[model samples]
Target chain A: MTDPNKPASVARRTISTPLILTAILIALALIALASGSRPFNQTVIDIFLRVILVVGLYIFIGNSGVMSFGHIGFTCLGGYAAAWLTMPPMMKQTLLPGLPNWLMQLQLPYWAGALIAALWAALWAAVFGKILLRLSGIAASIATFAMLAMINTIYSNWESVTAATSSVVGIPIVRTIWPYLIAAILSVFIAWAHAISRAGLALRAARDEPTAAAASGVDITKERLIAFVISGAVMGMGGALFAHSIGVVTPDTFYLTLTFTSLSMLVVGGIGSLSGAVLGVVILSSLIQALRWLEAGVTVGSTTFGIPNGLQEITLGIVMIVILAFRPSGIMANSELIWPRARPEKPDEMSGTTPTQQGVTK
Target chain B: MQTLFDALSLGSLYALGALGIALIFGVMRLVNFAHGDVISFSVFALLWPSTDAVALVFAGDLPWFLLIPFVLLMGAGLSVLCELIIFRRFRGANPATMMIASFALGFVIRYFLLMLFSSRPKSISLLPALSQPVEILGARIPLLQVITIVATIAILFALTAFLKRTRFGLEMRAAAENFTMARMLGVRANRVIMGAFALSGALAAAIGLILASQTGTADIQMGGAVMLMAFIATVIGGLGSLPGAVLAGFLLGAASVVMQTLLPIDARPFRDAFVYGAVILVLIFRPQGLIAAPGTKERV
Candidate 1:
């Protein structure tokens, strides 16, 4: 989606960012596969899922410079959708008896279920986005959060169809993780393609300079709605995979905890940078894994070393604050993972004078 | 009539929370995610640190006079302490950074409480006398309910007067309206911000006391639902508008109570969905909020 007028070298560098990210993810997946350890594999899978979510979040929030508190709600929707489509007919008939007769009778392969889940979530995102995209800044964020709360409330109380607050079990757990890797990769490409697309550019323009963007004939709300639906689709796919990973779907699972976790990762990584989105997940997930290991105890020579059980969360919070204090824009600071030396030689790019490069530098 | 009182009491609680949020946002662009944790902390301060099922009453045993000030002071002190330690460094950072930072700070407060008190909801029979039934017109209400309504009105009047009549209140209002301009015009930024935090913290404490009395329990997560509703109210009221926040808070509370009463029994559990749906509608129709605070429109 890079503009055709852009010089070949710059385009290559822009393309390298996603390629590099994909390579890194592939390497991690291969490492997990090689280890053949279930826990480590699960840990890697968890990180991949987060990458998809944060990347999905970045598609809208990073580009639009709008903070969203509702993407997780779409994940909840997708999880239930996946559960509805993939669960054995017997289980659905017995547990979710209020499901329509056709839905109760039907079951699909995991991929088909995930695909449908993505569409189902995206379809609703369009519905909700039609209303929410009209607002911008903090008001928009709040509206999204309200949407999430509404979804959570309905899902939690709609007993027969959703199993209400109880976890819907029997999702075919895809423990092997290849599917998650593919999905995560898909999310990255989608985010990358959207970021460079005309809509993404206009949305970023509106974000950085709403007045100027509007003066230039950009339909800010329409552009924002586009990002909203795309990001919604990505979040829905991630949510489906999340359900399959755990073989359970519950409304609360897609509430504040996951919302904050992904948002924290996105912010700590850098809100405006794609590399930041992916790296945030990788770095934070690694830190969490390390903390878990310490909590379980580690041997140092003849003695065991361990932190208190609750210390991990405290440390994580403290680390987030410390990081934000030092690097307010995030670790990436709106920069991508392009070739490090490419900028110095390209004086124009180094100065970040070009309109296209403004997002990168800012 | 009972339903109306119920609505008013709930609205008052939300209004207080929104006021706390609005005060800080008026001075700084921060949404103060930690405000909820502060509420939980204030209530927890009354009890001796314990992981046991039963609370060990400490300051909680104080007569209402001393106890009230103690909890309020705890809230103010903690709010001020957070400002001094954490928020002070984030003065000019972007809104997203500050919001996330506040959230992280709240996370720390919540987990810290968890470490000391455990996640168990502790029971504390606060102001047992307030639980007695009282007559008001045709309505039989808890004395606490009436007290809550009266106390909220009193606080609102006092706040309005303070803002309207005092030099410091004038400075605070100016800062809320325009921080940089106020600072340029001789309002001390640090003092005004700190004052806002103190007032906000005290308000959180009031909420803590109210919640503790109403539920007869103190839970780590108790502040969450109210905090979310208050947050919504704050936004729909207009981000930095004090009176707007209060009015929206009350409206949301009423809407919630009414939905609970009017919805069919099967739909009653989905009351919050209806309320939130209404919130989205309000935002869509009037994104600047029910009362748009001047100069709040995004500049960039």
Candidate 2:
């Protein structure tokens, strides 16, 4: 619910920044749509889609300063939702012979199907977040972690519904630079808008100082629930975008490794701010891509000193450790990486608590 | 009949692991989420081949004497190492960071073990006496089950004494209850926390070895399943309460067994599911946990 008292100053502030950003994003999207499988174009699309995930993570993680080891679960939920919904009905029938009669009857187009999948992800999160969002710290984490494990096991074995959930082969190849590009821009928009929204402010308040937020009459539970659900829903949309792009979906893609990848992005990029999320995704995604290029690129002379793809994991792990040890606040900290001229303000009540308050302590 | 008994033994082992996790979370208030992997490291310490004659003196087909001490020592050492390295640094961070760290560290240790021990589950041999069945109430229960039950009782007794009787344990309790006050009173805070971590690690390792010996396989991923059980147990019992974890562990174990009994053959896959469901049920109704510290937190 939008606050009845919409601080009037926010409206008069500026349309130029939002318009300029939207314009730049549209141009980039057009370029992506025009380019067909160009190497750099692929990279550009990939970077933005990942930003969607970082931004999704930033919603709760940045505001709350809590670390979640299970955001990959949300991403996985999203990917599976999109892939399953968008499949050709005939292929869906053949692949999921055991799919219930109702699902077999419905055949939707890619975009509509993606929307449905995102809704499903949001719905699942709404159900789970009711229980999850109330508890702070480790209890919340453990509950969420349990959720991840249970879902993983269920999906791993619930083959009939998930096309052998372990593997979903033969997805219709509809992914392109455009979808990823759109998702990236949309993701940033949603993320930026959310941080300034009432729920976002309340969630941030609870995160910064639960005691103060609660004392000041912010419904911490409601704020967290909203953030948790929205975050999951956006990640789901990103996953749908990713599935359409990749043309295939597998449980392996959603394992602890991917979880580590996205998390490393959040950590290295910084967890407290939107710009950090964007920078983390762009920098880390490019780092991995550059490493891949290096591996495939020729040696300077006779001897090669190229790093192996497997070593990327080592690099990522090392980066997380270094970031935690040194600049855990992130380069942008809580600030956005690309800034608009003017900024937003908060309601009368915001807490001074650090990540320690909102974080999963156990 | 013996399989029925084996479940109880397994339950005891689960209880021990839960106790370990519960203790650390209770005291330092961090999840000690790497607990399962820490147990795995200790299991490797035991299963690691040793050529010395003294190694045989403890387990060389000699009987149960060496095995118990060896397991305990391995557990203690691994626990101490975890404290000094990963855990000690994350003391002041929020529960979220510590937990994320634990989850990450667990993976790191698991992968490292995968490199060393191969992900394959390995087993060790024990005495015929331990393996052989003992007839009880028309059901043949394995002697190992009896041993586990006895040992669990013994360990609990010793643990209670250590925590309730000894000054160090009191200091540890004080630190857990009120850190600043304890520190103001001249209690060495770091030393006590380190002790708690070491003890937690030791307990987890011992249980890990027992699990491997019973289940006939030691795998890098083994700790996670059990760790989840421990987490469930700790939550069911109470977040920072030891007795709660123990009670929850036994309840979870028994419930799983009974649940399997009630499950239709096809639904058995969801026995663990039901266990997790139970945890969720408990958590929703009682957020402070089954037996939270009196007056610690009261939600408005």
- Fraction of true inter-chain Cα contacts (below 8 Å) kept per model? 0.88, 0.08
Instruction: Put down candidate 2 lDDT per residue, A134-235, tens digits, no spaces.
Output: 676656666776677666666666667776455676566664566666667777767666665667766777766677777877888788778888888888
| Interface RMSD, model 2, angstroms | 3.3
Task: Name model 2 segments beyond 4 Å from true.
Answer: A1-50, A64-74, A105-107, A131-134, A211-217, A250-264, A283-300, A304-315, A328-332, A338-362, B1-7, B47-64, B120-129, B294-300
- lDDT (C-alpha, whole model) for all candidates: 0.91, 0.68
Candidate 1's residue-wise lDDT over B8-124, tens digit each?
999999999999999999999899999999999999999888898889988888899998999999999999999999999999999999999999999999998999899999888
TM-score of the A chain in candidate 1: the value is: 0.95
Give residue A340's error in model 2 in angstroms: 8.9
Looking at model 1 chain B, report the run of 10 residues with the lowest lDDT sum.
B291-300
In order of listing, the candidates' clash counts read: 0, 12
Docking class of 1: high
Candidate with best lDDT:
1
For model 1, the stretches where C-alpha displacement exceeds 4 angstroms are A1-5, A9-11, A348-354, A357-362
